[model samples]
Target: MSFVVAVDGPSGSGKSSTARGVADRLGFAYLDTGAMYRAVTWALLQRGVDTADAAAVAATVGEVRIDSGTDPLAPTIAADGIDVAGPIRSDEVVRHVSPVSAVPQVRTRLVDLQRRVIVGTDAPGIVVEGRDIGTVVATDAPLKVFLVADPQARAERRAAEEGGSDTAATAASLQRRDRIDSTRAASPLAKADDAVEIDSTHLSLDEVIGRIVSLVEERR
Candidate 1:
């Protein structure tokens, strides 16, 4: 069986960068499940679909084709045959992603696609990261990491990533997303019972990546 590592955490918790680093070091495929949601949300907004309407969002989700590249060194995501790696990161898409992801139909569709990607990976293993990877997408993954950081740290990191956007506003947005993700009826953001929780509040990026790589080695 292919070894799988599931890294789950809320926004700005270093899930994406850390997971990508681990995958690069281990020669494993990397899947950013969050980007999948963003791709769908981007498509919805581009098509003028009302994200707030559950039925409309669900109906439109199936019509959009989302593709994720598994290469850790240069991961890519596209929606409806258009390159959307940059577009999905726009402020508009970010604002709607959580709500679009909350729709059960959207989750059901993307979760199936994610599983197919995991099973079909040509690498010896895969590092998958997102809010519910441990609890929902890859429950049977051999290594599950619940990465976390204090709100202040997370906000600072995110602000820096966004070209030094307002830290206070970023923190508030992260808090709002936390509430929505944790309370969503469909696979909520949560740590799996057996997951290893790692607090990245005070850890450097290299340090955090090294720890997770070490954990993966221990599992192997």
Candidate 2:
């Protein structure tokens, strides 16, 4: 049986880096569920669909094929056979992903895909990270971590990730995304009651990864 680890958190909370690190340390498969949503958003934009229109998004979501490679060292995502690891991170997709992800049909479809990936992992386990992983995607995961960081810290981290983008604007955009994601009608961003909450504001990436890795060891 795969020992699943569900890492849930808001944007820039270090869920991606921490989860990937944990997976690498343990030789586990890793899945970034957020990228699946971003891939869908990128597909919608490419198809000229208005992502803000719920109906349009729902109607068109199934037509997009999203593939997520699980290798921790070189994870990749593709939308309709097109490599989108880079495109999904573009500013346009980031701006529109929350809305596209809020569509019930979109969540329903992607959550099913995410579960399949988790269950089919050839490794002994998988570390899956996203807003809803602990609560919705893998409630039965052996270890659930809800990562958090102060808004300012998150903004700085995101700015660094974006190659020194304006921190103020990034902070504003993160806040906007937080409001949308937490209020979305579908699987909203929230901490699962049983999750271990880690405040990453002052924690080094190595420290965070080490903590989660220790938890996984304990659980095993």
lDDT of 2 by residue, 77-145 (tens): 999999999988899999899889889999999999999999898999899999999889999998999
Name every residue pair that clashes in candidate 2: none
* Candidate 2: regions farther than 4 A off: none
lDDT by residue (143-186, candidate 1, tens digit) is: 99999999999999999999999999999999999999999999
The per-model lDDT (C-alpha) reads 0.95, 0.95
